[model samples]
Structure formats: structure tokens, C-alpha cells
Target: MLRKAEDVLTTTDVRRRQVDERIRRLESRLVREHDEVPPSLVHEWIERASARFGDARVRDFVPLLVERAVRASVLGFSSDQHEMSGTWLPDWARNTARRLLADELPRRWAHTAGVARRARQVARVLPVEERDLLVAAAWVHDIGYAAELADTGLHSLDGARYLLRAGLSRRVCGLVAHHSGASAVAELTGMAEGLAEFGDERGRLRDALWYADMTTSPDGHPTTVEERLAEIRRRRGPDDPVVRALAINGDERLAAVRRIHRLLRRTYKPARG
Candidate 1:
């Protein structure tokens, strides 16, 4: 659990100077930001969040902090619900990824599509950039299966690291590397640290990614937690490395997912728009 999330905002021992630099560049007209909703719904996010979080000075960072808090809440709640639900794939993440799988591997894409759809649904709570990152991660999650890279046998880590090396955001890299931690795939391949760098440690972002990966199926679709666990049992039979690892940690992980799912659903419920 490398909890040393150094908030190294790009670079600096001089903190305020850095924030001041960004603030100085602020646009004259702040877009009166809203969640990803219709123009008609502009007031909805303000109304809802104001109702729950209440009024505070609408300072420059307040909105971002509030948004981050909302994202964290979503992750926390979703984790809990998934634990109980068993079928814990972050709904949006699973759905979007499922679709990608279907498109790439048409023969088996339907199943994968289900996974993508669920991933997408779960990702909806995130900011647009974060959501895009999640969707991209979910879609390409299984790309390691494509013969050229399967030899390493650590899809999440191996896949993500490759992309990061070429140049991708740390956030995107994080999801790709740690999503589901990919079956002890990292440990087996001695790349867990590298994978962890691509996100997926123990924070809210990691939790959200974790819940998304676990809840979705290899075949890609929503399902009950029991059914999901049963599928794992069936897929691996008994004593498979991945299966063993999942079962050993199943209780804690399931609980995490369930909590996140419940909280996120409430927090991110569609805006009035």
C-alpha cells in the first residue's frame, strides 16, 4: 500500500507560487461550470450540490474540491454496493469496455461489450477527462490477449506501461495498470509496482478503478456478486493462481465495491436537465 500520494503539482517546493501561477492564468469568463449535463440542466448541479454540500465561498478551488469530493464519494459508495451486489463492475466502465471488446473481437465481443457498458456507467460520476481515461482503460484492458504481448501474461500492467512509455497521462496509465490489479498478473510478472504507478493503489481513484474492474465480467455484462464469484469459480475450476488470489481477498474487495456503488449512485444521480 504505497500511500505516499505526493501532491507534487507538476513541480515545486514553493506551493503558493505554483497555485498563484495557475490562478494568474485563469480565464476572464469562468464557464459557470456544470457537470456533464445538458444546457437546460445548468442549474441542476448547483442546486443539488448546494443542497447537500451547502453554500461556501465559490472560490477558484472550491468547485474542484467539491467535484473531487463528489468523485471520492462516488468511489466510496460504489465500492460498498459492489461488495454486497457481487456483480460489482463500475456500471459505466463495464458497459463502455464491453462495447470495445465487442468491436475488436466480434466473435466474442458481445460479452466484452457488457463489460464495457458497465465500465462506462461507473465512469459517469467522474470528470470528463477522468471518465475518458476510465473508458479507454476499460476498452483496451484485454488487448494484451492479442498474441503479441500475451507472453508477459500481465495484461493490466504490461498493457498500461507500454502506453505510458509512449506518452499518456498518469491517470490513464493508473487505471490500465491497476484495474482489477489484473489477476495477480503484475505480481506474477514482477511488474506490480509499475502497474501501481499507473494508478490502482488504495485511494479513492484506485478504489473506483478497482470496483469497476471486479464487477465486470470477462464476457462483459452486469451480474450479481454471487454469480460473478461463481463464474470465477467455474472459469478457473480450483486453485488457479488468479482465482486463489481473488478468493483470498474477496471479502474485503467486495465490501469496498458495494460501498462505492451505493454512494456514487446517490451522489451522481442524473441532474434535472
Candidate 2:
């Protein structure tokens, strides 16, 4: 998972030690059950799981949460040191996004579903191996808006940080970080330095994600890019940095949408089994 040990919340030394001991015990039990799995790998999973809940206000149940997360990582799907893979990604993304956004941000959930719908529709434009990446990124691109994960207040970067730490594919995190002309917004907001951690990923994958996000409305309906831009300007007002960034990059974003539409027109096909 993404590394930054210092980012975990500060805790009393006694509580930290107790949590460490409980995780150690959990690792031992896992080692006994899956003797084939390396102890170091098990330990790494525990650490990553623990890091994820570092900011939780209630610390007493953190060990249990870590155990559940580690078990899911180990037994629920085929994953690697820092990437989730296989046919499980889209389903996992949907479930996770629902868990994070359904109750707290219903409107955003609708938007996420709309983006996922658009992604599935356009996935055919991508290679077979890459289709899932687009759809999965679509589902969780707005996750940083979740109350539990909104550390930076910049949704794109905060969401990408959580995705990377949670062991999603780097490509998925990159798409979320740079989606819908986020780089321009980040620059205008003075968050470019923080957002740069994900590295810039361009080309078809990024464009496809932008197409999905830019064409979807806050309430999750399909719309023209111009209409979406108008809505954002209205909601944020003329002086908002996001509106300013859009003013600067609006034409480029429209060009990307048009290019995606042309690709879909030329080679539109439903996703295949």
C-alpha cells in the first residue's frame, strides 16, 4: 500500500503498544492458518490495514477493523503487494463506494453511479485488459468527498490518496487524481505540489475517465459538457477557483469530450463477456 508512516494519527504510547501487540497476535494466528503465506507478508497486511484507520476517533475497535481488512485482503480476492486485480475490481469498487458514499452523500452516490454507467458504455474503446480500470475508477473517483476520508478537502487528491493506501491499482488512483481537468484546478488552488505525488498519467485511459466525469451531473444524469460546465459555474459562482480553472481549461476539456465522442461513434460496441 501507499507509504507514509508519519501520517497515522498520534496515539498514547500505551494504546499504540497494545494495538501493536494485538496485531502481532493476529499475524501469528494468520501464519498458523496459512502457513504457506510468508510472515512478513502477513505483517505488511496488518500494517497497511492499521494505517487505513489511523484517523478513526474511536480507537478501541481499530484492531478488530484491521483484522477484518487484512482478512479481506488475504482471502477475499487475488491481490498483490499493493494492487487489487482480477475480475473482482469493479464489484469491489462498487461495494466500497456504496459503503463510503451511499448514506453520507446520496447525491454524490448518484453521480458516481452515473459515471460508472458512462464508463461501462465507453469501456469498449479501451483494450480488454483496461476496461475494468475505467469502470472501477469511475465508481470511487469521488470517494474523497466521504466524511471519513476528506483529509485534504481537495477531493481528487484526497480520494486518490485513500485509493492508493487501500491498495487499489495505481492506474485507478491516477485516473481519479487527474480526472476532469483536476490538474488545472489543483494548480489554481495551490494544491499542485500535493497532487503531483500521484504522477501525471495521460492518453486514452485519462481521457476516458474525463469523459465519464465531465459528462455526468451532480445528480447523476447524462448531460453535455457545456451544460455541466454551466452548472458548475452556477453552483460555485464566478469567483471560485474551480470556476476560474474551468474558464482557463474549458475549451481543452470540451475538446477531450469531443474526441471521446468521435472514438465512440467510430467504434462503439457494448462491453463483451
Candidate 3:
């Protein structure tokens, strides 16, 4: 019985070392990618993933399972899509947003879900190359609202800054910074110049992102642009800086939404008999 107990202890120690080595290798591979995801963040994800398997009887597969889970968390790949190529920005964005906002800001998470859902629907109107990017922007647009990330007190700029450091493309960072007429608000808060760092993007991608955000309700439901605007006004009240910024740029936002509607209508095709 003592020999058996010693064997079990040795087995457990070996498994722990194996898991750590596998995680280290996985971290090295991930850090080589373009984003070069932070090693600390990668370790945190590995710990979270490993925690889920604590009750399992068989420990042989734990290291492999944790590696796969952490890789998915880092690269935003679903289990079936691990072998697939092309950047999965939207998935990464969704995971990042969830990590930051799900526990700390439930309502904001709902809003983000709604906007990302709407962005996916609207992406059909954009060119193939731009579709996922629009969805990606929608996913992380409000991450600055996360309590720990709200450094600038301006969610748009703060969120954009976070994404930029996370190695997101400049275009995505720009969209997050300027979503929903944030330029007017930035100007009001003296952050307009800061926003320019991402450069101003024009045309359909911008319009579609705005349309997705404006048409989604805070509860993650579809809503007309007017209703959505009214909801914000009601929630924030007229004294809010966001509401005040809306007063300045609301018309321009409305125009962008209308432009998207026209584009959608133009692309609409009646069912063929």
C-alpha cells in the first residue's frame, strides 16, 4: 500500500511537469504570431483552461486539452477550425471583449453582442475583404467600459488604445475609436487629436459599422435607429457628455445610417422562382 501511494505521488508530479512544459511550448508558438499575445495573458488563459479539468479522473490528456484550449483563446479558433487558415479577428475580438466585460459589465456585454450580431448581418453589404473586420470592430467597440480599462474615461479612445496594444490592425482600432460618431464626443473632451492617430477611414466599412451599432439596442436586440438613439438619451439623460455629443453629430450619424439603408436596398435581390 505504501509503494502504491508513492507511485501515485510520483505520477502526479510527472503529470504536473508535463503540463507545465506543454504550456510553455504552446506559449512560445503563440508569441511568434503577428499579435505576439502577451505571455502573461497566455499563462492566465492556460490556468483558466486547466482549472476546468480539475475533477477529471484521467490526467493523461490534461496537458493536450489545456494547450488546445489556450491556443483557441489566444488565436480565436473554434475546435473544428484549428486547422483552418485566415485570421479569425472577430473571434479574437469576441473573446477579448468577453474576458474584459462579461463579469464586470453585463449590460455592456449584451450591447456588444447585439452590435456584433448586427454587424454580421450588415457585413453582407460590404466587400468580402471587409466583412469580418466590421464584425470584429462591433465585438470590441465598448471594451473601454471595462472598469480596469477605462483609463481615459472616454470609452472609444480607451478601447481603441487597448486594441492597438493587443496588436489589432490599425483599421479595427480606428473603427473602435470612432464608432457611433465618437469624433464629436472626442472633440468635446479634447481627445479628437488623439483619435487621429488611427487615421480617418472613409466609405462603406465605416458606414456599416455605424449602422450596426446604431441599430442594436442596449439589451442586444434589433431596434430602429431612432429608437436606439432615444434609448441612449433616456439612459444617459440630456446632461451626459455622450448625449451632448449626440446633439452635435446626431444628424451626420443619421445620414450614415440612411446611406447604409440605400446600399442594402440596392443589393437586395428578390427570390428567384
Candidate 4:
């Protein structure tokens, strides 16, 4: 029995080291492929994978499964495709976000679509690059709310982390990371540090998304900021953490909404004879 116990311990130690080495190799490969992805993000992904497989009975395949799962979550394109530069959100991102949320959260799907529509409406007021980035952010802003992606229950951070892992542009990740007064809620959740890495997107783009998200109701209809805040309070209740946080930061959020509206009025001009 003593000899058998020693053998078991030896096997376990070797497997643990192997898993560590594999994760290191995976991190190196991800860095090579995604130069913009922060090392901290890569480490977080590996840690999450390790925790997920810690108790599995199949020790031999844990490393392989971890690699596959991490790659699937973070990589959305082939090597050649990643090398190309473009402004538009890829079809795969839209499809992936839709697949993750459409069946499980139909209301969210509708709201995302509505936000995308708002992004489109603002296209004429923004530069080409900004327009595309805003549209991309709108399409995937709420993806963190998807069941499969809600690791921290802070959709902005979760969605941004997933996108960063998938090798999306850092700007899009940043926008998703800090959208819709997420920083206020992040403070309440102890996730503000993780979200700080992405930084904030440009002011115009950030405010554009803020307007898109705040103006649209959960049911996907247009509404004023007052109505939207009321709706959120109604849905989440007075005692909810998000409600409390929003109340504390309501002035800042309302200011952003008003700023975007003013920007829209200044920039948008109707075509006339």
C-alpha cells in the first residue's frame, strides 16, 4: 500500500507539471498571434481553464481539453484572416454573439439588434473608422450577458475578456469593457481592476455606444434616459446592486447621454434641395 501511494503521488505530480508547461506554451502561442492582447488576460484565461478542469477524472486529457477550450473561446479567425486589417465587425462575431444569446436570452438579442440599429443611424456623423468600430461594439456589447460568457456577472468585463481572448481589436474590446456606465457597476463587483486594462475607447465612440445602449429599452424600443433608468430600476428593483450603483452614478451617466445627444444634433444634417 505504501508503494502504491508513492506511485500515485508521483503520477499526479508529473501530470500537474505537464499541465503547467502546456499552459505556458499556449500563452506563448496566443501572444504571438494576438500582439494586442495583454499578458494578464492570457494568464486569466489559463487560470480559469485550470480551475475548470481541476477535479476531472481524466487527468491525461486535461491539458488538451484546456488548450481546445481556451482557443475556441479566444480565437475567432484563421491565421491568414487575422493578418488582414479591416474596420467592420466580422460575420463570425455577429454569429457567435447571436448563437450564444438568441436562444437563451431573446430579449437581449432584440436589444442588441436595436443598439446596432442606433449605431447605424449615427454613421453619418462619425468618421469611417469610428463608424465601423461603434457598430462592432454595438453588436457585441451585451455578449457578456450570455450564459456561457458571464463569468464575473459583469457583462462588460466578461464580454471584453472573451473578445480579447478571441483576438479582436483592442478598441472594440475597450468599448465593450467600459460601455453603459459599467465602471460604476464594476466598482460594486470588485472587477474594476480587471477592466482597467482595456482603458476607455475614444470619447466620441464611447458616448455613441452610451447613447445607443441607454436610449434603447430592454424590450428594444426607443426611450429617453429617464424612462430607461426607470425601466432598469423597475426590472432590477430598488435593492439590487446595479440599481444602487446606478443611483450613485446617475448624474455622470445622464451627462454622457446628454453629451451624445448634443453631438448628434451638431453633426447630423438632413439632405435637402
For each candidate, what TM-score against the reference? Answer: 0.53, 0.66, 0.67, 0.65
Report, for all candidates in order, the number of backbone clashes.
70, 0, 0, 2
Q: Whose lDDT is greatest here?
A: 2
Candidate 1 all-Cα RMSD: 18.9
Q: Report the Cα lDDT for residue 263, model 2.
A: 73
- Candidate-wise lDDT, in order: 0.50, 0.77, 0.76, 0.73
Candidate 2 residues 96-154, lDDT tens each?
Answer: 99999999999999999988977776665677788889889999999999999998778
Better of 2 and 3 by lDDT: 2
Tens-digit lDDT track of model 3 for 196-270: 887668789999888888876787766567777899999999888899999898998898888887775455421
The reply for model 1, stretches above 4 Å from the true place, is 1-108, 183-185, 188-201, 268-273
Which digits, one per residue and each the tens of the lDDT, describe model 1 over residues 1-273?
233434454333364454444432221111112112211122233334434543344334644544544444334434432211222233444454444444566634554444454555565445554555555555656655444445466766665666566576666666666666463645654665655565455655555555655655555444445456678878887766667667556675677567656655564454221
RMSD of each: 18.9, 21.1, 17.6, 20.6
**Which segments of candidate 2 are over 4 A away from where they belong?**
1-86, 269-273
- The number of clashing residue pairs in model 1 is 70
Best by TM-score: 3
Q: Which of candidates 3 and 4 is the stronger one according to lDDT?
A: 3
